[model samples]
Target chain A: MLAAARDAFAERGFEGASIRGIATAAGVDPALVHHYFGTKDQLFLAAVQAPADPEELLPEVLAGGPEELGRNLLGMFLRVWDGPARAGGLALVRSAVGSEWTAKLLREFLVARVLRRVVGTLGYSPAERDARGALVGSQLIGLVMTRYVLKLEPIASASRESLVEAYAPTLQRYLTGDVVLPG
Target chain B: MLAAARDAFAERGFEGASIRGIATAAGVDPALVHHYFGTKDQLFLAAVQAPADPEELLPEVLAGGPEELGRNLLGMFLRVWDGPARAGGLALVRSAVGSEWTAKLLREFLVARVLRRVVGTLGYSPAERDARGALVGSQLIGLVMTRYVLKLEPIASASRESLVEAYAPTLQRYLTGDVVLPG
Candidate 1:
C-alpha cells in the first residue's frame, strides 16, 4: 500500500495526487485508507518512509543549545546512514534527486519539521532564522551529494567521524557566530 | 557532427566517449574531427557547452574584490540565464538530473573548471576550496530548480534584481566565508 502511494506520489506530484487515487492504486477502499491514515499528508509521509521524525530528533539535538548543534546533527545523520536507517537516508536523497514531489517532500521535512521548530527554539527573527537555516541546509545537502550521491574520492572514502570533526565547527558558526556578510 | 557529439557525450559521459565514435556517428572523417578540435578534451568541451566562461567573467566580477563579487556573480549568472546561452544551462541541468555521463560533465565543470579555478583564486586549501565550491554550486543549482525547472512561486515571481539582493550575499559567503557545517 505504501509502495503504491510512493509510486503515485512520484508520478503525480503532491498537488496532483488524490487520496482516492492512492486508495485505488493501493487496492484498498477509500474508507480503509481513512482508517489506516487520517490525511493525505500523513499518507504521503508514510509513502516516503523516512526512518524517524526530524522534529523528534531536532530538540534532543538542540538540547545542548547552539554550542554543539552542528556536531550533534552531523553525528546523528551519520548514525542514520551507518545503521538500519540507511534505506531511509537513501530514500530522502533519491526522492530529493528523483522528482519534484520528492524535492518538495524533502523541503517540507527540512523547513516545517526541522528548521522552523529549531529556529523558534533559538529565538531568532524570521530573516536571521531563514538565513541560518539556508546555510545549514546548503552544508548538509552538499555533504550528502559529495559523500553519497557523487561518491567523490577521498571525501567519499573518509570516516564518518572524520567528516563530523571537519564539518561540525562550520555548522557551529552558522548556528551562532556573527560571520561577516559579503558586500 | 556537433549534435551527434552532444548526444553521445550526454549519454556516455566524458571518459566513455571517443573521438572515433563521435566521428562515425556524425558521418564525418576521423581526420576531420582531429582537424577541427585537435583533442578529445576540446571536442568534449564543445559538446558539453556552458554559459559564459567564468574565466572571462570572473575578473570583471572581482574587479572590486570581496565587496562586489556577490553582485557581480549574480548579475553574470542572470545574464547567462536571460540570454541565448540558457540552452546549455537547461541541457546541463536536465542531463545532471538523470544521466551519469552528464553528471560527470557537470561535476567536472564544477570542481575542475568553475570551483577549482574560480574559488582557488581566493587562496583557500584544497578541502576548504571544494567545500566552499560545493556550497556555491548547490545554491546556484537550487536557484535553477526554483526559478526555471520547478517554477516555484515567489522565486519565479521575483525580479532579477530582488533575487540578487536576496541571494548574492549568500552566494558571496559560500564563495568567500566560513560556511556553517551540518550537525
Candidate 2:
C-alpha cells in the first residue's frame, strides 16, 4: 500500500493523486487505506517515512536562544542526514527530485511544520518572513544536493562539526540578520 | 547532430555517450561527428548551448574586488538565467538532474572553469579553497532549483534586483568571509 502510494504520488503529484486510485493500485479496498492511514497527507508522511518528526524534533531545536537557533537547526539537520534516519531522508530527496508531487508535499510539510514555526518566533513581517524562509530553504536544499546527492568533494567529505560551524552562521544571518529585500 | 547529441547526453551522460554512438543515433557516419565537433567535450558544450562561455564570462565576473565578487557572480548568474540564455540554462539543469552523467559533466565544468577559478583568485589553503568553493556552489545551485526548476513561491516571484540584494551578502560571506572548517 505504501509503495503504491509512493508511486501514485510520484507520478501524479499531490493535487492529482487520489486515495481511491492508490487503493486500487495497491489491490486493497479503499476503506482499508482510510482505516490504516486516515488521510492522503498521513499516507504520504508514512510512505516517505520522514527522517524526523518535526512536531517532536522542532521543540528540541527551538529550545535554545535565538542566536543558537542556527546551530541547533543545522545540528538537527546533520543528525537527520548522518544518523540512522539517513536512508529515509535520501529516499525523500530522490523522490522529491523525481516527482513534482513529492516536491510539493515535502515543501508544504517543511514550510508549514518547520520553517514557519522557526520564523514565527522571530516576529518579522509576513513578507520578510517569507523571504527569510525561502533563503534558508535555498541554503539547506543546496547543502543536501551538493553534499549528499551529487556528493561534491570537500563538502561531501567534511566532518559534521566543520559543516555545522561553516553553515550555522549563514543560517543565523538568514534567520535574524539584516537582509535587504527591495520593495 | 546537436539534437541527437543532446538526447544522447541527456539519456546516457557524458561518460556513456560516445561520438560513434551519437553518430549512429543520428544516422550519420562517426567520422562526420568528429569532423564537426572535434571532441566529446566540444560536442557537449555545443549541445547544451551553454548560456555563458566560462572563459569570456569568468574574467568579467572575477575582475571586480572580493567584496563585490558575490554580487558580480550572482548578477552574472541571474542575467544568464533571466535573459535569452534561459532556455539553454534550463535544459542543462533539467538534464543534469535527470542523469548522473550530466550532473558530473555540469559539476566538473562548474568546478574546473568557474568555482576553482574564483577560489584560486583568493589565496587560501587548498582545503579552505575546496570548502569555500563547495559552499558557493551549494547556494547557487539551490537558488537555481528553487527559483527556476521547482518554481518555489516568493523566490520565483522575486524581481532580479530584489534577489540580487537579498542573496549577494550571503554569497559574499561564502566567497570571502571567514568560514571556519576545523582541521
Candidate 3:
C-alpha cells in the first residue's frame, strides 16, 4: 500500500492520487487503506516518512529569541538531513524534483505544515509573510539540493558547524530583516 | 547535432555523454561536431542557449564595488531568466534536476564559468572560495527551481526588482561577509 501510494504520488501528484486509486493499485479495498491510515494525508505522511514532524519540531526551534530563529532553524534542518532519517529526506527531494505531483505535495507540506507555522508566529502582513516564507524556502531547499542530493563539493564536505554559521545569517535575514516586496 | 547533444546530455550527463555518441545519435560525423562546436562544452552552451557568456557578463557584474556585486549578480540572473533566453534556462534547470548527469554538467558550468570567477575575485583561501561558491550556487539554483521550474507562489509572482531586493543581501553575505568556516 505504501509503495502504491509513493508510485501514485510520484505519477499523479497529491490532488490526483485518490485513496480509491491507491487502493486499487495496491489490490486492496479502500476500507483497508482507511483502516491502516486514517486519511489520505496521514497515508502520505506515513509513506513519505517525512524527515521530521514540523508541529513537534518547529516549536522547539522557534523557542529562542527571534534573532536566533535562523540559526536554530538551520541547525534543525542540518540535523534532520544528517541524521538516520537522511534516506527518507533524500527520497522525498528526489521524488519532488522528478514530478510536479511530488513537487506540489512537498510544497503543500512545507508551506502548510512548516513555513506558515514559522512565519505565522511573526506578525507580518499576509503578503510579507508569504514572501518571507518563500524566500526562506528557496534558501533551505537549495541548501539541501546542493548538499545532499547533488552532493556538490565544499557544501557536501563542509562541517555542519560551518554550514550553520555560513547560512544562518542569510536565513536570519529572510526571517526578520526588512525586504522590499511588491506594493 | 544540437538535438542529439540535448538528448545525450539529458540521458547520459556531462561525463557520460561522448561526442562520438552524440555524433552517432545525430547521424553526423564526429569531426563535424568538433569542427562546428569546437568542444563538448561549447556544444552544450550552444544546445542550451546558455543565458550569457559568463566571461563577458561576470566581469560586468563583478566590476562594481563588492557591496553592489550581489545586486548586480542577481539583476543579471533575473534578466537572463526573465528575458527571451528563459526557455533555455528553464530547460537546463529541469534537465539538471531530472538527471545526475545534467546536474553535474550544470554544476561544472556554474562552478567554472560563474561561481569560481565571482569567488576568485575575492581573496579567500581556496577552501573558503570553494565553500562560498557552493553556497551562492545553492541560493541561485534554488531560486530558479522554485521560481521557474516549480513555480512556488510569491516567488513565482515576485517582481524581478523585489527578488533582487529580497535576495541580493543574502548573496552579498555569502560572497564577502564574515562566515565561520570549518577550521
For each candidate, the DockQ is: 0.14, 0.40, 0.45
The 0-to-1 C-alpha lDDT of every candidate, in the order given, reads: 0.67, 0.79, 0.81
Order of candidates by DockQ, top first? 3, 2, 1
Candidate number that wins on TM-score, 1 or 3: 3
Q: Assess every candidate by TM-score.
A: 0.67, 0.78, 0.79
- Candidate 3 lDDT by residue in tens digits, B1-183: 998997787567555789999999999999999999988878877865676667777777987878898899999988888888787776776677667766766776777668888988888888888788888889998898788766778998788888898888888888988776532
Q: What's the C-alpha lDDT at position A181 in model 3?
A: 55
Model 2, A74-158: lDDT tens digits are 9888877888887777777666666676776677656655678887788888888877888888888888878776667888878
Docking class of 1: incorrect
Sort order, lDDT high to low: 3, 2, 1
Error (Å) of candidate 1 at residue B3 is: 9.6
Q: Give the TM-score of candidate 2.
A: 0.78
For the second chain, the TM-scores of the candidates in order are 0.76, 0.74, 0.76
* Model 1 Cα lDDT, one tens digit per residue, B1-183: 788777777567655778999999999999999998878767766766766566576777667786677778777787778778776787676666565566666776666556666677788877777766666665666566555654443454557776677667667767776564321
In candidate 3, the second chain superimposes onto the true chain B with a TM-score of: 0.76
The sequence of per-residue lDDT tens digits that candidate 2 reaches over residues B98-118 is: 667667667766676678888
Candidate achieving higher TM-score, 2 or 3 = 3
Better of 1 and 3 by lDDT: 3
- Residue lDDT tens for model 1, A1-183: 777777776667655778898889888898888788778767766766767667556666877777888888888876666678766776665556556667666655565555666655677777677566655665566566556555444455667776687667656666776543111
**Candidate 3 on A3-30: residue-level lDDT in tens?**
9998887567656789999999999999
